[model samples]
Target: MLGGGGLVAANVYASATEGGWGGQSGPDATGQVKSAGMATIDCPDVGSRLTNVPDGARADVDRALAELDRQTASAYQQLQASAQALSADPHAADDSVMNPLKDKRSATIERIAVAIDRVGDRPEGLESLAACALLPGQEATGGVTGGTGQPTATASASPGGGQGQGGAGQAGAGQGGNGPVASDYADITAVQPNAPQPAQQADASRGSFTSDCGVNANGLRNSDNVIVAPGVSNGAHHFHDYVGNQSNNAFASDDDLAKADTSCVDKGDRSTYYWPVLRLQNGKQERDAGAPGGGTEGNAGQIVTPKQVTLTFVGNPRSKVTGMPRLLRIITGDAKAFVNGPANANASWSCTGYEDRQLKDKYPLCPSGSDVVRTFHFQSCWDGRNTDSANHRTHVAFEGPDGSCPEGFRAIPQLVQRIVYDVPAPSVEDGGRTVPLFAVDSFPEQLHKPVTDHGDFINVFDESLMRQMVDCINSGRTCGAGGDGGASASPSAGTGTGSGATAEPTAGASGTPAPSASNPSELPRTDATTTPAHTTKHSAPGEQDGRGEQGTDDTGRRTKQGGRSGHGAQATPAGAGTSHSAAPSASQAGEIGQAAQSPEPGSGRTTPPPAQSEPQAVHGGLAETGANLWPAGLGTLLALSGLVMLIRAKRLRY
Candidate 1:
């Protein structure tokens, strides 16, 4: 939750605080390049506010909203291409991009209003949302600065481990002149522990259900976002790494997903889980390099598959959990938070050894032997009404500050996604030119900010499996398919406190057997079960891995998993909290295990102790951060008026 004052401050000093390493500062470098003061189009977010949309008009409204996204992407592309022209004449942005985009949006918005009016009361103020403006993206290419905000020199690094002095903008050329410059990264050790402690409850649902969904080993990549832009191709404007349901696409309906084969080891779980792919700016073009959601959209570089993916559903700390309805679709975190603000932003980043200290806006530079971790704590409170909402958020809400659901909402299994990637930490000082930089795929306008990272899930669990999950969680049993999630480890060790195992990509046509882990705790061993395999596909031709062909062991061999993500980290959107203490909780003795050594391959599943630490709790709904700006603005105006009166009285006395 960002307050109005904070939002204003963020917008005002974003470049300085976010380390806007803009274009070249001196003429000592190469030929002409896009100068700093990078700008992107910003329009009012209409979809989020349309909560009362009629079901009859849902289709029309959704399509129109998707059209809005399409319009924004196009305008952003035009802005990037016309950077030099806009730099020469500020008015050029409006004449060439802003005005045209507003016109298109106005027409689309009218269609929405008309459709709504036919079935119900049409919404007002949508027309006012049609206008757009250029937001300051990056600083003008000038003196490069690091996190310290002081002038600093920069060198470019090639993918081949080679480094050389290049133009200040060279570090971002691979990203289509967008961002993720040296200032976007911070060392993990430098971040102090900031997560607050969770409330202890007497009747908490302490158990969890783990689903062993393989990582996207079979290479299912796409840019379509079925929940937001159904039937529209490249709706996401960025590539997403997908696991679980194989048939998901832009046109996928609930039925299409329900009938699809799953990548989860359990046959009953066909849920689809996905998030934006992480890429290394190593100069190698991926399969989507030339495609709409790839290079054309400014998402360049090689895609790096996750070394591990953990999907766990845990009980609420305040109450027993209920089953999530079939076909439930939940989206956590806002993809467009950079321009839209951090109202719904929920991205949490950390490293293997430094899990206590989580970062919301900056990427962590992991030390050697450590992996980068991305955690998404989905909304845990359901409204107990519709499985989905018109705004896609109103149906589900996060619990209250006291860990209880808001009125009309019920506690449900909280889905905590912990994805691990094994890539060398980028040296932000040299702008990752010497050691290639890595970034999460993002809309061209987002500039690949870590805060913009998000994840999506559509629950397609079979009735029986869904029931089992509810039962396991409510009864306080740590259960998973076979023994995959029955083992646990120290949260600091970053092992299998989660209920699920790493989703390794399966092999061959009929699905490969779930890989055996030497230590079930290290890998969160899944049942040696294999689902019926489906044909492997990429979103488009050349959307394949451009480099790093060596796949991580599909077998559960990863030792360093994610730390026990507490609800305190996910629930506090304001980034408020005391520095977390490393002392083990009193409950850890019962929830954790002392398994010290890795089991041999094919070792039996160890029955984990009853309950692990409560899976991180996710407070749902958009948290209002700063206060409204009008009051503050009024106060400032009144004070200025008083000052004028005082000055007039003094003048009269003189």
Candidate 2:
């Protein structure tokens, strides 16, 4: 019985020591082992009797027991070592130890069970049961849930090297199982550390000429004068001429006098001047003649021939003798007779010619008539002189009858007569010959209108006042006064009834008592002339009535006029009446009323009145009292200080 028990225990110990039972199969192909009965028994079983055992059996049993003890001790020691390693360096229960320990511990537990079953009737089997409790491996313990039990290694090939692999697997799991990685980094490219580039320069040549200088050349000449030929009735005309004298001790000729004397001048010199001339004509219409049968034959009831004549002379003080010679009658033959007509007609034909002269006087030359003529003359001497002096002599002559001569008459002048003859002064260069410096050029185009002369009469009128009047008429308002007198008045409160009290409350009403005729004037009139004496007389009555109506609902009942509250007769105190009451007349009352209803100053009530005074001083009383507080020099000081501060700040920054 001992030999059998010893043999069973030895086989059990050998099987228990195998390493494949924990599913870690090594290169040594250990066969699969079967499980046995429970190692710990609750109750001992009764069996066959015990016998004396041989020495070999005893030795084998001792050896089996010893081997079992060694295995059990080793298993317990391994467990303790793992526990200590995990405590000291918590990663020691790595896969290298865990896999082998799991297989061996599982196998030993199975073998211990089998040994217990095989030696069930023997007393020594109980010791083997106790040793089975000390098996070595359990699910390799001493590490985080999915962590490898090893130190992180720097080398790639060691057992610890797999730590990096394990870590990589952990990281992958963390990312895959969760969400995206997060971090913060600045976009350095967007940072601007330098000043912005200066704006592109503009093309200097592209701007406008008038815009830069603020004026246009073409506009300057728009106001110059317009020149008309011959002349209008109230228009200006210009002419020029020359003359000379030969008296040895000669005073100036008329031309020299004109150029040098300055006095007795009736026209402009070489420059320009203005003249206005008017002409009149006379005739009797056939209706003015009575029936002619009662008149004599040749007379035809005293037949008359009307006459035409011209009268010419300077009207202004600036006329000169230099221009007189150029006055030629280029179209008329009787130049001398026309010039001295009033004198000559009286001598020729006696009373008949005088009658003709009277006829000519009746019909003054018409400026627009077809028989008009202009005259030109040369005056060479005045009282016989060649030098500039007061007594210069002059000459006169005739030029043309022109082609307009009447019936059987020659076109040339019928008489050529010289009114004066005198030798000219010696020329400065040629001793015997004289040069006429004052000679007139026949060309009419050289005489242009002067820029200063705008014309005889410029129509000067006020455009702004005309525009205002037009606007007023167009807007349906009376240009002068008194139209629809009350078109501008405010509406009344009494539904257009009860003699013009307001039919509705104004926008400002708040249920306070309406103003009474007896109320004390809220505003005092500064002008003594405008204030009423009745205000002082009714002061007591006004105050008493105002106090009684306080807090009542009569606030907006009556209409106000010139600040006065009443139906018709009763009036408020001075300054209490609306502006309308001061309209002086009922015709203008509505206009004044509308103006009063508009607004008040500083009350934030309606459109404010224009500011009538300059603003008060902004600084304290010190500034107001000090004489030098705002001296002109202080502005320069402040500007200099600002410039210095700006320079300093810029330097520090750089």
Candidate 3:
């Protein structure tokens, strides 16, 4: 009980101080590369769209950015001076120093924060900036620092290797994201299929292709690591998810991904899918992995996994479907729906068992037995020969009720991706209000801005798998990852003749698979969006590994209790506790296992949702670590905490 008490205290304190910018310096090499990024500040393309903007608004934006630039430079200079002082005398805070560096850094961030607020008023301008890869745009190139104001990139994902590892990728560029099926979404005693009804997917003249990639937690959170289009410059500030190649990065080439291993069970399937990572805001936190400790402000625990991941490509209702080209990444749900008001709320939102109860509220909770979920269904109609459009989405359109491609659009495999998260029930049993959860990223700085959440994908499916998927759906066979998701590939499959040309080109003229994890393009409203976790260089105050006494890197990737994660470190988000501790509440224990396991797609019968549990013990940390922008500590702790916060803040900025 005493040992348990200590563990509980650590978690509570950690939870209280999970997020916020830390004031520490980032890794030297990574920092230098990100800082030296070649992007310049200027949105010339945005100026072209000025007519759509209000008169003189362009100047306002310029002024605001200039202010950001000016403040940033001053703060940086001051920060350097403070660092020099610290070098001469390590005293920080009361001991012998005031940590002028932290002060200046905070001031700079505050000024930038204000500038961001003013610019946020102009949504169109931001979008254009994102689309055009203007100032600080990342696109394929990593972003510029605006002169060292941006936070350093967090620790890189470690090389994949661990227990329960499984992932599907294009070919064999890299190993699958590590960690085997430690848990499933729910209890499997009563498991069954979760596919749409036959009529919902079938039309006499169309065909489809589909795969079931399990939940992903390793995709990079950086927006600059473009995984879709080829050789595009910094064109976006928004964040997205990526998959397939483990080493896939902003500079990854097509050949790199083609050699990557698959994360799914189907080795032949080489497609990559990604979506926005979600965060629970009702308060969850941990302290071991470099995250701060102690705060009354509820916790923002570990980054969460989507409950489910489903990928499908179908044809327009009236036309025969063609096999898709290799590197076609598309978006389905409207991230902007959560922001920019109701007009853009076209993306689907709902819980598992509460299907009838579609969610209009941002971050709605799931019913007692259901999971938090989001679904993205791409267009089925395509322009016969082209794989993309200038804007990225217009080339593909959905089929109407009649099952026909309206005009020039011919049928291609339509894609539908459904991602689910095993969110636990709220603490207040009596109340029915949904606690707010959010997804934070490097862009848009406005925490909890719903529009910032988005999903994307780059289909690198080998043509054989593509044709097989097409054959499976056209023939009315319900199949998945080489298994019977709803039904087996029909004995009489290949019933319908295919659309498009019979001969598939050798991916590109270079004779490689199309662009994928190594090559992805941004599609404005139409796209989807992977990363692994790594240990950090810094350790938090009173931090320990899962073994209790062993030290940890405090990077939030590995926990003291051995509950590790790459994205926010492996653990439940929002109201939950760490996965490292062996003794989770009865309900939490179940959640840990469920979240670790991949949800199986079956006919109406699927894994049964775990029974809801009452709120467990309400414990708090014994030793508190303050989360204030300006930390209060006895010299050393202050420097450490403040430094960590600065790192957290800037690294997470978009």
Candidate 4:
């Protein structure tokens, strides 16, 4: 049964015990081996039966049970690993001979059954091991029918490990004489089509830009600006599918990044677009996961070739937007989305050719000429405050069904990611498969589950390309003539060439506005003014802002966006400081000067401190202005006005 056999806690990276405070079992809870339910890894739940056996008998039982414990944990590791694969992309459980889900489960049950025979006469160690064969609650238990929550077994079975006396004989897959294994996802249909099924809805006022980022078939990339995760040991821990900026990494500065090679049709667009590496886990474990002293998690599988990768941003039709600055990381779809409720989960899985078939855990076998796709809708309405949140969420939220945001939440360009995989058409032999689906490289503790498989993006786009994306979505035109934001109709990468991959770039791709001129009727205004109010600093695309590339200061050469704050290494600490400091050069000074006076697009009024990044106490002795000097003109006006008033009343006052 697919019961919750989670080996670790929710925060796998936090502590050795994972996340729980549950203490170890002792003479008190004699029979029960409970966990803190918070993810404590140090619990002796398997051998509670050996608690009180006689001293002479205890040592042998302990030795035999120790080996049993080792075997069970090993099986559990493989089970969790396979489960993680299935979770990320449900179709991984194909019924092929290479790796079948049922075979794994069957082997695990047999291993425990053999271990129990070793315990022989020791009833304590023998009894508890039987219970675990159930995988706790009912789910992955498969063939064993009837009854629920942990399997009930009889220790009365013979010492030799033959089929146990009565009916519990199915314990060993060896005894059942079953012809073939089965799948947990076999003939299961649960996910429903979204209310609107993500129909074609384009806010003419909210423009959209769709970039056809090239399809990459193999190998992990480590570029200048495409840093996937920083704290993960300086980024050697994982690898993602990068397509936009050639120079993308954790430490790549925006300036060096802008000139890198781009896989997108728009040669100038330097935005680094990436997601988890979708692996084709056959037998070969391709990419390295930084082993020995660096990192333990590595991915060994064939990389799936994407037929089409469309990157798009559609602004809420009702808001006026300008441009997003550098170093913005956006995430959508919860890797833990298997849990119910939209409050924290939004992972959607569907086949490109089959909209009616939506499953939370599995994808349908695509017919010939079709592919698998994962669609993600990022929170569009922002707080007009922080660029990044504590959990990398929070600061932004999804729109209501009516496409409106709650008060205080201003709308930004809604970002949408669609990656299409050229998976092979399902064959009859591919049913009941397990652990064959691929995912991007990540830590092992994450279980590589699709529910925890989320996408990440850092906007390193050249000023013109980013501005075009922001403006297109803001203006409400659906760009991307060569591609639709969703339904990918492009040629396959490194393989087939069916969907017109050879077509030239569209006019929008040429940096020209699309549908805005023909249809400009905007959506209902959310506020008194249609223009969105920004709370962070806005910079023209490519221009060096407070936090991007650094400039030479009076003191010495220092980092521009991320300064050497002696506080702590964590960027964007709560109530601490932002990634940038006071102005370092004339361009940044002019940014404060000129942008402060310009209004947000469509506002029709002078701007009020064009939205700045998350608010942090300004550090560094440098001032926003060139020298922080008062305007001489304003000072002279104040002096003249006071002198005029004095002269007019001087004679009469005396």
Better of 2 and 4 by lDDT: 4
Ranking by TM-score: 1, 4, 3, 2
The sequence of per-residue lDDT tens digits that candidate 1 reaches over residues 1-654 is 124444445455433323223322222243112223245667888999899988899888888998898899888887777665665666767878899999999999999999999999989989999998777545333222223222223322121011123322433433455666555666665565554445648888877776766556556778889998888888888988778888888999888998998767666788999999888776665667788888788887767656567777877877888999988889999888888899899878876545555677778776443467788888999988787888889999877767799888899898888887666666444455434567898887777878899999999988877887888777777667333334322121122222125222111111111233421212211221321121111222122223212122222111112232211111111111221222111112121111122223233222111111111122111332133344455545555666677788899999
- The per-residue C-alpha lDDT of model 3 at residue 557 equals 21
Worst 10 residues of 2 by lDDT: 208-217
Candidate with top TM-score is 1
* TM per candidate: 0.68, 0.11, 0.44, 0.45
**On residues 509-597, what C-alpha lDDT tens digit does candidate 3 reach at each position?**
11111122311211011110111011112334344423243232322222332222211112121111211121121122122112232
Computed on alpha carbons, the lDDT of every model, listed in order, comes to: 0.62, 0.19, 0.34, 0.37
Model 4, 1-654: lDDT tens per residue?
A: 101112122123224232111111111122221211110011123332233333344333334433433333333334333542434443333332113323443454344445444654323333332332211211122221111122223221111111111101111111111101111111111233332322234442345666556554222243111232331222323345566665565556557666677656556556776666654433332334233111223233444545445566666534455566555667765432322223454544444433333344333333322345565566777767665553456556787765666788776666566665544322111211211333434333233334444666666656766666665565555554243432222323322111122221112111111212222221111232222122123333234654345343331212234332111011221211222111121111121102112112232211011111212223112583324323433444555666667677797898
Q: TM-score of predicted model 2?
A: 0.11
**Could you tell me the lDDT of residue 374 within candidate 2?**
16
TM-score of 3: 0.44
For all candidates, what are the clash counts?
Answer: 26, 48, 104, 57
Question: Which TM-score value belongs to model 1?
Answer: 0.68
Which scores better on lDDT, 1 or 3? 1
For residue 523, give model 2's deviation from the true position in Å: 90
Deviating ranges (above 4 Å) for candidate 4: 1-192, 195-206, 222-231, 234-238, 254-256, 287-298, 317-322, 336-343, 367-369, 425-442, 480-654
